[model samples]
Structures are given as C-alpha cells and as structure tokens.
Target chain A: MANTNASAVKKDKKITWKEIKRQKTLLIISFITVVYGFIFCYWPLTGWIMAFQQYKPKNGLLHSKFVGLDKFKFLFGDDVFIKVIRNTFCMGVLNLVTSTIMAILFAILLNEIRHTLTKKVIQTVSYLPHFLSWIIVTGILHDALSSTGIINDLLLRTKIIDQAINFFAHPNFFWPIVAFANCWKETGWNAIIYLAAITAIDPCLYEAASIDGASRLQKIRYITLPGIKPTIMILLIMNIGNVLNAGFEIQYLLGNGLVQSVSQTIDIYVLKWGISQNDYSLGTAAGIFKSAVSIALILVCNWWAKKTGEERLF
Target chain B: MNTKHIKRSLEDRIISVLIAIFMIVFITVTLYPVINTLAISFNDGIDAVRGGIYLWPRKFTMKNYTTVLAMQNLVTGAKITVARTVIGTFTALFANALLAYVVSRKRFLFKAQLSFFWVITMYVNGGMIPIFMLYKNLHLTGSFWVYIVPGMIGAWNMLVLRTYMLGLPDSLEESAQLDGAGYLTIFWKIISPLCKPVYATVALFVAVGQWNSWFDAMLYNRMKTEYTTLQYELMKLLSSVMQQSGSADTAKNSTAAITPITIRSAATVVTMLPIICLYPFLQRYFVTGLTIGGVKE
Candidate 1:
C-alpha cells in the first residue's frame, strides 16, 4: 500500500511539471501583459512626486525641489477651483439623473413598439452618435446653435423668441447646454443596456400583471421597473465613480473666454496648470485630488448598493 | 361596455401617435445636424456662408473637402491616425485576451487578487499628469509607440473579456489537455473561435477609441508639424483659420482661404466618416457584447 501511494505521488508531480511546461506560452504572454500594465499604468505613479515639488521641466522630477502641500493650498485658496468643483459636480449630477431617466423611458417606450423593423431602425440611429468623436459633435452643436442654424430658424418661425439666442455664450445656459448635449448624444446609446435589461425580464410577469387588470403604466411601474432595478443600481454605482469626469473635450471645445467660469472642470484646470502653465506639481496635485474624490465616491456607491441589497460593482 | 371599448381604442391610437412623433423628433434632432454639416462641406463657398443649405447642398461642390485635404499636413495626419488605430487595437486586444485567459481559470493562484487589482485601477487611476510624466521619463515622448503602448491594457475591457471567457465550459479545456494539447493550443484552437462575438466587440471598442483619441497626441506629441494625429491636425487647422480670420493676418496667409463653417464642417465629416462607415458592420455584436459585460450571472 505504501509503495502504491508513493508511485501515485511521483506520477502526480511529473504530470504537474509537464502541465507547467506545456502552458509556457500562455505564461509568457501573461508576463508580457503584466509587464505592459506595470510600465504604462504603474510607472506613471513616480510623477506623483511632482505634486509635492514646485516642478519645472528643466529641473526634472527627480531633481525638483519639494514644497509640501503648497499646490493643494493654492488650489483650495483659489475661488476659481471651488467654482470648478461645483460646476463639475452639478453637471455630473444633472447628466447622471437625466441620462438614466431618459434611457429607461426610451427603453420602455421602445419595448412597447409593435413593429420589429421600426424598433431596429430607431435603435441603430440612436446609438450612432455615441461612436462619433466629440470634436465632430461639438462642431454639430456649433452649427445647430449658430444664428443661421436650423434650430434658430425653427425657433424664429415658431415665434418662440423675437431674436436668435446666443446659447453658447450665456453662462446661465452652459450647464443646460452640456446636459442637453449629453442627452442627445447618449440617450439612445445608453438605452441599449436598459433595453437589454428589460428584455431579460420574464414575459410571465407582464402576463400576470395583465391578468390582475393592471394598466400599461401600472405594469411598467410595478413589474418592468422592479425587474431592472439591479442593473440600474449597478450602472449607477459604476457611473458614480466617474462623477468628476464631466468630459474634457466637449467642454474644452465649446468653452470660450465668455463662459469659461462655468465650463472649466478639474480636467481642464489640470490641462491649464500642468500643460499650458507648465506647473507640473500643481497639475499633479490637482489630478491626485480628483482621483481621491473618485475613489471615495466609488466606495460610497458600492456601500450603498450593498446596503440596498442590489448588485455591487465589486 | 361598447362605449368603454371605443374610448380605450381611441386612447391607444393617441399613444401610438405620440410615440411616433417623439421618435421622429428625436431622430431628426440627433441626425439632421450631422447630415447638414456634411451637406455644408460639399456646398459652394458663398452658398455655405449664406447658411441656406439644409437636407442637401444649395450649390453642390467638393471645394471644402478638396481644400481641406490639400492643406499642408492633412494627408500625413490621416496616415498617423489610421496607423495608430490599427496598431493600438491589435496590441490592446492581444494583451487583453491573454490576461483575461489567465484570470478566467478558477485554479489559477492569485486570480481573485489580480482581478481586484485590475478592478481597483479602473475606479482610480494615477490621472493624466503622472501618466504624461511616466511617458516622458521612459523617453517615449515623440514615438508612435507612445500612443500604442500606454493605452494597450484597458481594465474594463480585460474584465469583460475575462467574464466572457469564464462563461465557457472548462470541460473543453480539460478534454483538450487530456488529449496532450497545451493551454496555448486550447486557447488558440478551442477557446478563441468560441469567443468571436466578444473579440469583435472588444476590437470595435478599442478601434473606435484609438481612432478618435486626440488627447494623448495633444499632450505628449508637441512636435506640431510632424507628429499631429488627424483629429489634432484638423483642430489646429480650424483654430489657425479662426485665429487668422479673427486677426489682421488674413491677407498675408491667403492660401488657407477656407471659411470657418466650411473648414469646421469638412473636418467634422472627414474625421467621422471612417468610423461611421465601420459601425453598421459591428452593430450586431454591440447588443450582445453590452449584455455580456453588464449582466451578472
């Protein structure tokens, strides 16, 4: 019995060694991937040191003189930074709320469509804008909102206004414009996930609602909405982590000096300080601040999701 | 009873009409602006300025496209953008697939820990400044590899691919192994073909991202004349035209006679056309791809 057990152990060891050797290619590929991650994603962390230093391009990060929290102090003391934080948060919240609601409504409406061909065509058209570059979308917005653009022409013909409104120039319209632009670009695309969620809801629930004499709205409120709550919660948690990212390109493109106050987010601030002004330390500090906030928001959202008995990101 | 049934049918008809109107208005709002820009790009210069072009060109001409294409650096920028997308997508998908395969294996030691590490990175990154400095330190500042290497590993894409991989039966791999086939063989021959939908979806995501990306090029690629990607090049062209037109320097630089509206529209159309053309082919995979990534078992 001892001899048989010993032979079996030897055989298992040999098989394991052969298996490792056989999987050498996969191991090598994975090593390359890990190395790539370390190099690009991990190595950049060294530059975080500049957050402490009054960094100059001439005096490289290694040789730069360190000043502790001066950049953060400057950022906090600046009224402009506070306004940017508010603008970023407000826009983020508006976008999150409106987009989610629009997406769900659109998905529900789409589900009610009886014609299969019409449903497919609308879905196709709606998602197309999501793929376009922000540069192009900004250009489209500029044209549509311009004095002689179609929107102004329509509004004029309808007598909605006595004159063409300079929508882009007004600070009051900045957040609304951003929110509307996001809705226009994303409502259809965002609806896809919700549509998928809705489709997965068992048809029996709808039948049960009908048998119980529930109207369409009641059925939607009780059955369809509840069925996709988990997906909504998961998506909400994931998007909360991105509350700080009010998009860099659209704001950068659309923003002029007139409405710069409302348009400048943390990202644009970092670009101005870090790249344009060449204050690497200040830029790094600002960036670190944004990341810290994002991490905290994500953790909070995850906790909320768990507490609510919904599917969490983790 | 008859009156109630008639009222219900009337309400249903009204609802259908409302829905149709809403969809029509939404589609027009979303699509017409883009299409109008395209029409504007093909219109005659004076007609384009008058802003009457809508639905179709007033005086049909390709003057704007030709002018924009003939600009000093447009062709080179186009080449750079195309090359970046192709190369970046290839490297990213390969790295993502390999990493995903390793993590998909339940028996792999440290699988859970590795997944957490990747997931954490997605929620919090070192931010752009640190990333720029890292690229500078590595001496990848002016190189094409700068675009490809830094963006190769996307944590979200990796996780999605890993989840898709996990959904596959392990028996396929075990049986292959029992037959003296290696993990590499199993992955290439058995698993890869099965994951075509996910692969295509991931490819579309990476390809579109790389194609549209101008931020990285703007940040690290300061060599304006030589290294500008297509989007950046178009941005510079428009901004310079805007500056020149807005300034007293127009007469001196009369070669760039393109108007703001025309140039802007042309740039928009050119940058967007390739991807728009590519989108329909990948539309089928998008719904499937999204559901796989989002829906938990």
Candidate 2:
C-alpha cells in the first residue's frame, strides 16, 4: 500500500512539471491580464480612499488630511444636491417604467403581425435610434422640441394650444421628455430580448390552449405572459441597481438654465462639483455615496428575488 | 377555398387591422424626426428658420453640408473618430478575446480566479472621480491614448466572449495540444478563426460603441480640440447653435447668410449618417448578439 501511494505521488509530480511546461504561454497571457486587472480595476478601488480625505493635488492621496464624512454632510446639506437626487430618481423611474412597458407592448404587437416583410422592415427601422449617439438624439430632440418645430406647430394648428410651447424650456416637462426620449431610443432594442424570450416559449403550450378553444387573447394571456415573466422579473431586478444612472449625456445636452432644476442628475452633479470645480474629495465622496447606495439597492433586490423565487441577477 | 378552412373571425381581422395601423404609426413616430432633420439640413438656412419645413425642404440648398464639411473642426473630428473606431475596436477585441480564451480554458489552473477578478468589475467600481484621477495620474488625460488604453478590455464583452468560447467543442483544443501546438498557436490558428461569428458580433458592438462615444473625448481631450471625436464635434455644434439662437439678432448683422438651424441640422445628420448607413448590414448581427447574451442563464 505504501509503495503504491509513493508511486502515485511520483506520477503527480511528473505530470505537474509537464503541465507547467505546456501551459507556459497561457501563464504569460494570464500574467499580463492579471497585471491589467490590478492597474485598471483594482487601482481605482484603492483610490476611493481619497473620498475620506481633504485631498489636494499637491499633497497627493497619502499626504492629504483625512476628513471623515464632511463631504457627505456638505452634499446632504446642499439644496441643489437634494434637488439633483430627486431629478435623478424621477427620471430614472420614468425611463425604466416607460421603456420596459413600451418594449413589452411592441414585442407583443410585433408578434401578432403576420406579414414577414412588414415585420422585418419595422423591426429594422426601430433599432436605428438605439445605435445613434446621444449627441445625435439630443440634436434631434432639440430640433423637434424647438418652439417652431413640428410638435409645437401641430399643437398650434390643432388649437391644442393658442401658441407654440418651447417644450425644453419648461421645467415640468423635463422628466417626461427625458422618459419619452429614452423610450423612443431604447424600446425596439429592449424589445429584442422579449421577442427572443417569446420565441423560446413552448409551441405545444400555445397549441394546447388553442385545442381547448382558447381565443387569441386567451392564448396570449395564458402562455405568452407567463412564458416571459421570468425574463421580465430578471430584467427588472437587474435594472433596480441602475435607478441612479438616469444618464448624463442627454440631460447635459438638452438641459439649460430653464430646465436645470429638473435636469441635473447625480452624475451631472458629480461632474459639476467633482471634476469641474476641482474638488476631488467632494466628488469622490459623492461618487462613493452613489456607489454605496447602488450596491445596497442591488443587494436588497437580489435578496428579495431569492426570497420570492423570482429570476435574479446573481 | 372557403370550404377548405375555417373563415377568419371579425375580431381577429379587426385586431390585425388595428395592429397594422399601430405599426404604421410606430414607423412614422420613429422616422419623422430623422426625416425632419434631414429636410432642415437640406433647406436654405434662412428658410429653415421661418419654420414651415416639415418633411421636405422648402428651399433646397447643399450649402449647409458643404460648409459644415469644410470646417477644420469637423475634418479633424472625423479623422480622430475614424482612427479611434478602427484602432480601438481591433486592439480591444484582441485583448478581450485573449482574456476570454484564457478564462474559458477548462483545465487552466487560474481560470476561475481570473474570471472572478474580471467579473466583479461589472458589479462595483471606484466611480467617476477615482477613475478620472487615475487617468490623470497615468497621464492619459489630454491624450488620444486615453480612448484606446482604458477600453482595451471590457468585462461584459469579455464574459460574453468567454461564454462563446466555452460553448466551442473542447476536443478542438485537445487535438491541437496533442500535436504539440502551444497555447498561442492554438489561440491564433484554431480558436480565433473558429470564433469568427462571435468575433464579428463583438467587433460590431465595440466599433459602434467606439464610434458613438463622446464622453471619453469630453473628459480626457476636451481642451485638445484636434483630438475630439465626430460625436463631440456635433455636441459642440449643438451648443453653439443654442447659444447663437439666444443671441440671434446680434449674429444676424455680423456674418454670412448661414443660420444656426441649417448648420446644426447638417451636423446632426452627418453625425448619424454613418450609423444609419451601416444599420441595415449591422442590425442582424446585433440582434443575434443581443439574443445570445440575453437568453443565457
């Protein structure tokens, strides 16, 4: 028995050497990647330490005086910051609800369409906005919402309003405009997932419902709805974490003094206070706050998903 | 024919007709804004400002395109954008694919550890300031390398590619190994060629992302006007248009007959033209890519 164990150990050692020799290239690649991970990924995480410091560029992070929670206190104390948070949350929820509903509705409508050529064309046209840069979308939005643009012209011609409405200039319209813009841009692209999920539903289930004299609406309700529920649940759970990422580009572009009250998001605030003002610690603290809250939201949502036995990101 | 099958019901027919109308409205909804912009771009600058142009140019002119295209900023922005898209996409694809291949290797000793190391980045990050400061420390700020270097590997794409790699038959690698092919040889000669479908998918995604990205340009190279992207240029044109509109009476007395509306619309069109042109060819790949990524548990 002892001799057999000794031979087994010897064989394992021999294989280790041969394996190492064979894996040399892979090892080198892994080493480079690991180094990249350290520099780009891990390094920034370490730099989050500056969030606690009264950081000055001259003093560097290590030399900066540590100031615990002062930046947080200041951020919470600021009325503009609170308003920014409100705008962010409102836009975020609006975008999420509208885009998700539109995607689902569009997918269902597309599924009902029988003409292959028409369906193909519509699907192709729909995803075009998803590919467009926010810069381009914002440009389109600016033109369309301009005082003399088609929307205002139509409203005036229909006597919906006696005069042209500068949609972008109205603070109250900001959140809805952002939501509608997001829905327009993302609905088709987002619908692709639901369409895919719909395709994966068992055809037998539909047939079974049909044989039972289920109407079109009945079949859709009994099968299609339940079929994509998991996908919907998972997507919702995943997006819960993104409630703060209400976007920076569109808001920055479309927003002016007129709608700034409703347009400033947390990211914009970070850019304004953090990078633009050269207040490193303050920005870092705001960023840290955002990251913490986002992480907490994701965790709670994930835990709830597990408890409910619903589809979850984790 | 009537006797061969059950006749269509009124409700189904009505519902189908309603769906068709809804689809038509959807198409019009998506396309009208773009068509309006195109019309504005082609209209005479002063004519466009009078604001009757809806779907077609009221007074047709090519001057807006010609003049905006002639600007040094647009030319430089276009050059930088194209260079970034081509170079950034290929290098990032290669880096990401390599990392994906490494992690997807079933028997590689460090596969799980390395995969975990990269995956965590998707969930948590040091946030904007830390990364901005990090780039400053690395001297990537105000440099074109800022676009190429930091984006060399995207964790999400790497994971997607890794998933694709794992789906490939393991025997391909095992047989190659038996022939004494090194990992590099197997990766370059065997894995990458076989990975063309996924590679194309990832490449399209990365290229489009690089082409449309202006935030990076705004952050790292805003002051370096020569290094700005096409999208950034469009953004600047937009803001300038807004500023001019605000001070239109003063601007009307000073310069050429050009109006901000024409220039802005032209810039918007030019910014979107490439993607619009490529959409027909690229949509299928992106659709497939999305489904593959989306459906995976």
Candidate 3:
C-alpha cells in the first residue's frame, strides 16, 4: 500500500508539470503585467531615493550625492512651503465640511420629494457637473465670474456691489471659492451613497414612526438620519484620510498671480518645484512627506474607526 | 379635530410647496451654466463680451462653432481624445479582467500572492515625482502611449473585477474544464460572457477616466500638439484667453464679430456636450457601478 501511495504522488508531480506547461499563455500575460506594474507602480518607489540625494537628472540615482534630510529641512524652513502646507490643510478642511454638509442636505431634501419623476430628473441634472473635467468646470466658472460676465452683472443690478468683483483674483475668497466649487461639482455625486443608505432602511420603521404621530421633520430626524449614520461615518473616516488633498487641478487652473499664495496645494507645489523647475531632490522630499503623512492619516483614521466600532477600511 | 386636520393638511401643503420651489431653484442653478454656455457659443462673440447674454443668444450666429472646428489643433485634439478613449478603455478592460480572472481562480497556486501585489498598490504609491522620473526614463514622455500604457491595469478596478469574477458560479468553469478546455478558453468563452455587467461597469469608469484626463497631457504629453486631448486643448484656450492680451492669434485675427470669450465658451461646450448627451442613458449603469464598487466591501 505504501509503495502504491508513493507512486501515486510521483504521478501527481508529473501531472503538475504538465498543468504548468498548459498555463504558459497565462503565465506570459501575467509576466507582461508584472513588468508593467514594476515599471509604473514599483519602479517609482525606487525614485523615492532621490529625496535623500542631490539628484541631478544627468547624475541619475546612483551617482547623486546623498544629502540626508537637508531637502526636508529646506522645505520646512521655506516660508512659502509653510504657507503652502497651511493652504492645503485649510482648503482640505473647508472642502470636507462644505461638501459633506451640502451632500447630506441634498440627499435628505431629495428623499423628501415624493414625486418620482421630479426626483429622477433632479438627480440626473445635478450629476452632470460631476462628469465634466475640471478644465471645463473651471472654464465655465471663469466665463461666468469674469468682470464682464453674468455673475458680476447680476450682482451689480441687484445693488450687491457697485463694482464687478473678479472672484478668482482675490486671495481671501480663494479657499471659499475652492470649497464652493468642490461642493457644486461633487454634492450630487456624493449624495448617492447616502441615498442608497436611506433606501436600505426598513420601510416598517417609517411606518411605525408615522403611526406614532411623527411629523415629516421628526421622521427625517429620527428614522432617516439614524439609518444613514453608519454610511456617513465610514465615508467621513475615509475622507479624513484625504485631508491633505485639497485639490490640484482647479487650483492650478483658477489660480493666478494674485491668488497663488493661497491657491497653491501640496500637489501643485510638488509639480512646480519638482518637475517644472527641475529641483528633483527637493521635489522628491516633498513627495515623500506627502505620501508618508497620507499613509499615517489613513492608518490612524482606520484605528479610530475601529475604536468607535464603525466599519474600518482594514 | 376638524381644525387640527385642516391645520395639518395646510402645513403639509406649505412644506410641499416650499420643496417644489427649492427644487426649481436647484434645477435652475444646475442648468443655467450649461445653457448660458450654449447661448454664449451661439451669440455674436463681440456682443457676448459686452455681458448681458443670459439664456439665449443676443446676435445669434454659428461662427464660433465653425471657427473652433476650423482650428487644426482642435481637430487633432478631437482625434486624440477619441483614439485614446477607444484604445485606452479596451486595453485597460482586457488587462484588468485578465488579471482579475487569474487571481479569482482558487486552483491557481499563486493566487493570494499575485492578488497581494495589486492590493498593496491601493495603499502605497511612489508619488508623482518618482512616477514622472520613471516615465521620463522610460521614454514614455512626449508620446500618446503614456496615457494608455501606464493605466492598463488599475489595482482598484482589478480588485473590483476580481470580486465580481469570484461571485460567478464555479460550476461553469468546472464543466468547461471537464470538456478539455484550458484556462484561457474557459475565461474567454464562459467567464467573460457571464461578467458583462461588471465589465460594462469597469468599462464606463475607464472610458470616462480616459475621456476626462487632462493632467497626463499637462505632464507627459505637453511638448507635442498631436497628443493634446480635447480637455487639455480647452484648458489651454481658456487660460490663454483669460490672460491679458489673450494669445496672439485671437488678438491678430480679431474680427468685428468674434471675441475670445465666445470662442472659449464654445470650446467648453464642445468638450462637455458628448458626455452630457450620453449621461442620462449611461447614468443607470454608472449608479449601479458606484454602489456595487463602493459598497459591499
């Protein structure tokens, strides 16, 4: 019996080799993907080495002299970098608050609308801006808010202001405008999750509330809000991880000389200093800092979510 | 009791009326910019700069559309956008589904390890500088291939597709294998057909991503006009016109009928209209994709 079992095992090994040979096509495809992955995803990770080096493009990675944390020190010491970090966090927080509130409010308002066709049309129209590229959205904003455009004209006719205000020109309005633009673009899209959550609430709960003489406002406050709380909390925790990502495109496009101080994000800073100006080492250092902080934030938020007994990404 | 009933009905009526009014205002806010853009594009360019054109064209003309279409660069951009959308979406979907299928097979010895390689990428990346440096070294910069090649496999999309492929009945593949079919045949013949719903979902995402992408143009393809996407071209036009003195051509070609703003508004409409027109029809699929990919872990 032992001898037969050993022979059977040997036969299985032979068949395994044949099976592997049959998988050659799949293996080759996987190899190609693996190479692609390494070049695009993993290889750039090695470029993080430039963060600690003087990093001349001509010198490349190996020959570049190591500079330790001097680039980081420089980034920290620069007033502009400090201000850019402030701008990033400020805009991030502003966007998070305004967009979140607006989305939840829109979702709740949408839930209240009893007419089905009206709800569908409203939802369909509102989602249109979210599909548009930031370039087009920025263009629309630029056209409408230009000194000679409709917004300024409306403001003037309504006696809100005597002069037409170029909305993008002022640093004071930059963060709020960014926040408002984000809200305008994303509120409808973001409301989708909340709406889904609302739908999942047992209809019997609403029926019970109505039987208890609950007002529509009371029904929303009690039944609807609680039903969607878990979804909101999970989304909020996830968003907290992205607090440094204020945005890059809209800021990059809308920002002009006057508003640059307030408009520059960590991403735009990296692009400008790292790629555009060719300060590879300094740019790499900034990139490393951003990645590190992002990872840490996500992990911390996950931990917090776990502690609070909410859904954790991990 | 009758007074209370009357009061309650009256309250509900007022609430409904308020909601209707609010929704009207909301719809107007959403629709106004798009209609205003359409109006400006058709309005006489020089008249548009004077700024009272609201819902309809003041001095109606199609010259802005004609001129925008006339630009050789705009034509090139349109071609690039279409080409990239088709090629990028096709390759990305193929590669992603292939990877997902391979990883979904429990019989595959390296499934967990292979899947880990992609899942880890969801959390960590080399950041933009390293990626830019790597692309520069790869000679992918200044080429159209940069857009399609790097994004051929999105880890997040792969994971979602894998989850979907996993949910497909194992008996279908098993029966095919029993009939002497290989993994590729089984995947292509059976799994791909069964996975159409998810495929469409991922395809929409990839297509939209490719269509909307402009940053890649700004980053890698900036040196060449041939690779400029419609979005990137629109961005350039918008910025140039918004800048003082605008660009030289607009200033030089200054006709009595056309202004840069009108041209820009027309271009903006051009960039957005295709997606907008298809949106209502496509939105059902998109909403399903979002919920499916977003929820259920």
In terms of lDDT, the best-performing candidate is: 2
- Please give the CA lDDT of all the candidate structures: 0.81, 0.86, 0.85
Q: Which 10 consecutive positions of candidate 1 chain A have the poorest summed lDDT?
A: A8-17
Kindly list the per-residue Cα lDDT of model 2 for residues A103-154, writing each as its tens digit.
9989998998878898889999999899998888887887777777778888
- Output per-candidate TM-scores for chain A, rounded to 2 decimals: 0.92, 0.92, 0.91
Model 2 regions more than 4 Å off: A1-17, A310-314, B1-5, B247-255
Task: Write candidate 1's Cα lDDT for A1-314 as tens digits.
Answer: 87996675456434365756655665576677667677767767777888999887888877888899888999999999998888888889898998998898889888878899999988888988899877767767777887677888889999999898878779999888888889988998888899888988999998988778777777878999998888888898889878888667878878888899999988999999887887878888989988889889988988998898887778
Candidate 3 lDDT, tens digit per residue, A75-136? 99999999988888889888998999988988988989978998999999889889898888
Instruction: Evaluate residue A203 in candidate 2 and report its C-alpha lDDT on the 0 to 100 scale.
Output: 91
Off by over 4 Å in 3: A1-29, B1-10, B245-255
TM-scores, chain B, all models = 0.90, 0.95, 0.91
Output candidate 1 Cα RMSD. Answer: 4.3
Full candidate order by lDDT, most accurate first: 2, 3, 1
Model 3 local distance difference test score: 0.85
Q: Give Cα distance to truth, residue A265, candidate 1, Å.
A: 0.5
Tell me, by TM-score, which candidate is best: 2
TM-score of 3: 0.93
TM-score of 2: 0.95
**Candidate 1 chain B, poorest ten consecutive residues by summed lDDT:** B245-254
Q: Per-residue alpha-carbon lDDT of model 2 for B1-297, expressed as tens digits?
A: 753488766877788888889888889889999999999899997666678888899899999999999999998999999999999999999999999999988777677788888878877888888899889989999999998999898888888788889999988998998998888889999999988888888999999999999999998898999799998888888888777666648445645667878888898888889889987887767777787676566
lDDT of 3 by residue, B118-162 (tens): 877777889889898788888999999999999999987997798
